[model samples]
Target: MEDKANKAWTDLIQEYQIDNAIKQHGEFIIQAKDIKKYREPRLMAKWDSSESLPTILKKSDINILPVSRSAYVLSNFKLYQPFPENDINTVKYVPPLPLESIDFNNLSTESNAINAMLITGILDDFLGTNNTVETFNGRMGTNDFSFTVNLTNGGKRQVDVQSAQLEIDGGFENDDSIIIMEAKNVPHPDFHIRQLYFPYRLWCERVRKPIRLVFSQYIDSIYHLYEYEFAKEDDYSSIHLIQQRNYSFQSSAISWDDIQRIIDSNSPEIDDNYDDTSIPFIQADLFTRLISLIEQLDKVPNMTSAEIASSMEFDIRQASYYSSAGEYLGVIERPLRGHSQLSLTGIKLMRLKLRERRLELIKLIVRHNIFHDLLSQIIDTGEFPSREAIIDRMRRYNVCKDATTLYRRASSVSGWLRWIVTLPDTTEEFE
Candidate 1:
């Protein structure tokens, strides 16, 4: 899907001599009609992350920003900002309402997650307010405004907007402030600043009260909300994080005893014919991200690698790595020519509720002798094994032969073990 957009943008760039235009005038304005000559402007221009940028734009360090309903300005400006690592130690707020109506386990979209947050009073608790009503949401036209964005060339340029399109995933307001939210389900390292900035600037022009920009991400049954503020209202480069909180309705407290129970009662026998080379050794970490990918596949099955990359806002190689990790877990199936789909085991796992689903996944992961043995040692010694110890175990299991590969694979082993150990309700460090 992204490849098509890349090629179309490449052609459009050449046809319009965009490189020359920018060199001469500091920036170039391209109309939606001009972009539609090859591909839909919406598809070509909506890059929400640095990894999702078209090849041509990425190579030139150029980003596109909409200046009006029909036009976009292309320039070499820093447009994406990184999200700070979430504090895994944050408190999880259990909503006061009963969990009967909203099924936290089956939230499939950003809208569903946001609605769930609102219903459960998670939003209220995070915002430090009691009376937050859903005041505005969805797409709306922005009033004309001007802002300055720092260019990649160490200079600044003033950009004027004329009623550009702005979309707010959710907006809640009380007496003193309006919270403008942009929500996402898949976890990305960074996001395009425009998603929050446009709506914020528009509201600032129209509202007498303060406007707060909030970015929310739903991953692995947790709602991570970040509140940001622009230090200089007219400067797009001034976005900064003010506060962040993580919440989950379901219990995430998994102790060593819980893991021991699964290990003793449900550990699968090591097959004599099991081949270590049958699937790639698990190199992908971020167990939460792996769960996120599985949930995405469960909701939209048969997604191609490019589609997955685009939706997850990661490069195609990272997409392939996560998919391969999924395959190794027996949760994802990839065909030779078609898209990737969830396996039968994945379907069954997804059908379970939040706690049950996590436990089931843990069970699946520990099915291997390496994980099972490592976990048993952790239970016995109450200490995590060192990298050298893990590498030695991999040697015994014939997991891989190359020393460099062994080290890379050992990190994944350690990562999964950390994930399992930290599942209990306690403050732990996360990489």
Candidate 2:
């Protein structure tokens, strides 16, 4: 799909002399009809992030934005903004209301997660507001508006819009302001500003109250909310983060004793002759990202490798690494036909509550000899084992023979161990 889009755009650009036009005017407005000559404008223009841009546009550092219902503007401008690093250490656990109807364990969509957050009062707590009501949402046509965006060349371009379509995942209003939220279920490093900017500009014209733009992402059972503001309302590039918060309905507090208990418990021993060579050694580092990948697999069964890479915003090779890591843990089945699906074990693991799910994950990781031994050493010494020590263990177990591979895999081992040790203790109360 990406290649096809790239080819279409490349053809369109050459045929229409868009490059020359942008060179002269600093921007080029291409109508839907002109784009439709090669490909559907909707498919060609729907780049949600900078990484998703077609080769020509990305190489030229050009961004595309809808200037009107029938036209799009292309320029060498900064259109995508990176999300701030999420500090899960500061996550606040907001208990679910007694009458909550949403089954958070099976959340499959952004709407489901957002609704759960609202019902549990996570949104209200994060926003410091009460009686927040969902007022306007879904696709709406924008009224005529204009904004200025900074170009990569340190120049500015004026953008005008008339009846261009914009959608709000959720629009919540309190007495003081209207919150325009753009929700995403899959994690991405950054997002296109148009998702929030268009709705914000439209709402500002419609409402007398202040318009607050928020980006909501639900990943691995955590709802990350980021509130952003345009310092200059009419400047598209003026968007900046005001504050951000992480929230969860489940308890994120897991004590060291809890990990210790898992280490000491008597469980079925791993097969002694299990072939380590059958699967790739773990190179994917972030444990939470692994869990997030599993969650995505649970939601959409039998996803192709390409779909996984596109949906997770990972490269094809990284997708393979995570898929192999999942298979190594005996929770994912990648068939010869190239479709990846959760194994029976993975499906059952997903059904467990947050605490049990996490514990089950820990058990799965430690079931392997290397992680088990490393975790035991950590418990005994109260310190992480050295890289050399971990690499030696990998060598001894015949995990990998290549020195570079061993070092990379050792780093992954250290990362997972750190994640286990840093779990917040449940006994501590958060005020």
Candidate 3:
């Protein structure tokens, strides 16, 4: 019965081409990867070398030292330590913290997965630990964060959506709180506008107060919380996307850090084509700082001075002192120059890049790999794995890596693959 129903819906969509709504713009995809490959001896050992997070978070309680900008924001709004309670349809905003030490040792895939499972009902375990979030199931009006519906008198009753989110009766919340938490499994990037708009419309049409949109995701070890406010008070549902005509991006929630990287990853060639009206509101210097914050390491797969220079695309003369620059940036510390043995920092950095940056780039590489595989199976079984085959696969995705001035430099990071946006699937379809 369900299959028949789904077929009918699918037939209707295809008949009317309803998929064109989102697809008319483009499909978003992340290359699929078999994550087990990353857990090899070379990489995991280093990331695990840090003191366990339990000790780190307690000592770093000085309320500073962010592992990333997103970390900084999440730390500031962490109502978790002493869970916040909802008062009167409002949430208290925690003030920003000062920096003391970056304590990333706390982040774990399981911890993140557990958080996501709660938010989206997608997974149950995180950081190898049982998710205790179910303890708060159905309990609301306790946290400074809550979602509530203000039902009016003498109106057709609307059914409240039941989900695993902290919610409360608006009348019970304090009037001073300003932020609304909208947690999702995979909301469209413009999800901010949607989450805020409907709620804002419902509330303003009934009651009156300020609203801030918060997007939380537990995909990686970090639970990203995004804050969004309308450009103007009258601007509910008034999101002006970076590109609307092309619908280049869905309304799914996008992290500030991810958005920043997208902007940074863009090449001058891409930038030249974009008008001032396109880019999001961002600071140049902050973006530069974010780029520089790339993890430093103790050892990197040991690139010799020549190989290191070659990676940097410098000539032999330039290559000779390459490790010096790497060392200067704390990227590598070698006992002697030519030997290119890694310092502890280099080894750690290499591991960090592999572990952290994998989702961003390697998954895309997998998509590229699959594209080649599919092409080989159908297009040319004989001249398989041809250069044209690879190029064609990549081209469909708009992966213009070869066209970049710093192609070698930029392509080194796997996150570079996120820029490729030509697939026939929404991020979900790919997943």
Candidate 4:
């Protein structure tokens, strides 16, 4: 049974290898071994919530400070420098993109989406460096190498990863360096360093130019690009974030007045179709996250909670929250007694025009009682409501919580409403 379970887990990981570069890069993290051996939730005991125990041990059992020892003790550990502070004064100009003429309805594949960005000059705008394509979908290295993987949990083993199967979606040559890219459709908190490391290594051997590793995500009509480099070249685990920024091919500006109109209407006639009980009203970017969930469902319909969590590299609890949000929007369903799947609404959502989809979401929010009532009040007031005012509104609706929790929930409500009101239009301008 254990053997079967391990195989199942490995298979699940393989299924989620959307691109060859990411897949090959992940091998160093898990080392082609059972995932159970590398679970590192235990390292979070010192700073994680006091409400629950970590997966590997009790808080009292661990003696070392996690800030210093996390990488030494946990497999797939990520070490990041201080986050880059947002500087509003330094905003760069985002020129118009070539995506204006492309039809999003037919842009289903990752390669196609990537090509659109390239042709549209998004790469140059976001990275602040113009580049020409050097190679696309190419491989290097011979298939005859085995290395010992030093496990974070104090173990070492040999594994054969034949020739490093180095693949990159797009390689760009700028003025002084080559940028090796690994692209994904979803934005993740962190990525396997191997994705950038192996390619950087292979190319360094073939060319004298400096190599820069880039991870790109195209989501919700915006492009998020991150650049990374290994602190110690040839060290698969030395990846660190150099810089990260978000850019939109078109402006995503939305105004408070625009949101007021939606709040004052009955376009979304309330119905008994939504289930808000299991959904959190306080999550960050809940609407966009829900849309991302729908995209995953569109790719692989009828995935269980565990499968969805694994595929998206989210914790099971987080996966549940996203799935529940989809259910609340009436975009997902469970035709089988125990299995969850996309409903007719979700399918139609995938097929609709992008503008139509955003409108549908606005209508859905206006149709929900809590969102509708609260937003109506906020809209009626000429200014942004205070946190106290928001919490008071929540209290009136029986969404009561403790002081801290209420404050956080209120912030979420304000942010989400702002996001809804400011939903970007599909209209575009060509350079």
* Most accurate candidate by TM-score: 1
Model 4 lDDT tens row, 1-431: 12233343344345544124222453223332233343332322222111122322221122111111122122232222222322211222245443566654444456766776676676766567776565645655433333344444454434443454445778888787788887766545345444565577667767788888877766665656778887765444456777776655434544454566566666445422214354445443445666777887887888877677555545556666667657767788766543567889889888765555666677676776667866676567646667787777777665645677667667667766765644533324433
User: Evaluated with lDDT, which candidate comes out highest?
Assistant: 1
Segments in model 2 whose C-alpha atoms lie over 4 Å from true places: 17-21, 153-155, 260-276, 282-289, 306-321, 366-422, 425-431
Per-model TM values vs. the true structure: 0.83, 0.82, 0.26, 0.62
User: Compared with the true structure, what per-residue lDDT tens digits does model 1 show for residues 1-431?
Assistant: 66788799889888989888989999999999999989888888888878778777889778999999999999988888999866465547464355676666677888888888887777877888777888899899998899999888889999999999988999989876899999998877789999999998888878898888889988888778999999999999999999997787665666667888998987665421226356778887677778888988988978988888877776676788889888888899997644788999999988876667878887988888888898899989989999999988888888877899889989888988887776766522221
Stretch of 10 with least lDDT, candidate 3: 242-251
For residues 56-123, what per-residue lDDT tens digits would candidate 3 score against the true structure? 22232211111111111111111111111111111111111232332232222333323333443222
How high is the CA lDDT of each candidate model?
A: 0.83, 0.81, 0.29, 0.55
In candidate 4, which residue ranges exceed 4 Å CA deviation?
1-103, 125-131, 134-167, 174-176, 192-194, 228-255, 267-285, 299-301, 373-392, 400-415, 421-430
Among all windows of 10 consecutive residues in model 2, the one with the lowest summed lDDT is: 266-275
Order candidates by lDDT, high to low.
Answer: 1, 2, 4, 3
At residue 329, what lDDT does model 1 achieve? 85
Compared to the true structure, candidate 4 yields what TM-score? 0.62
Better of 1 and 3 by lDDT: 1
What candidate 3 gets wrong by more than 4 Å, as runs, is 1-6, 10-176, 185-193, 205-208, 231-236, 240-431
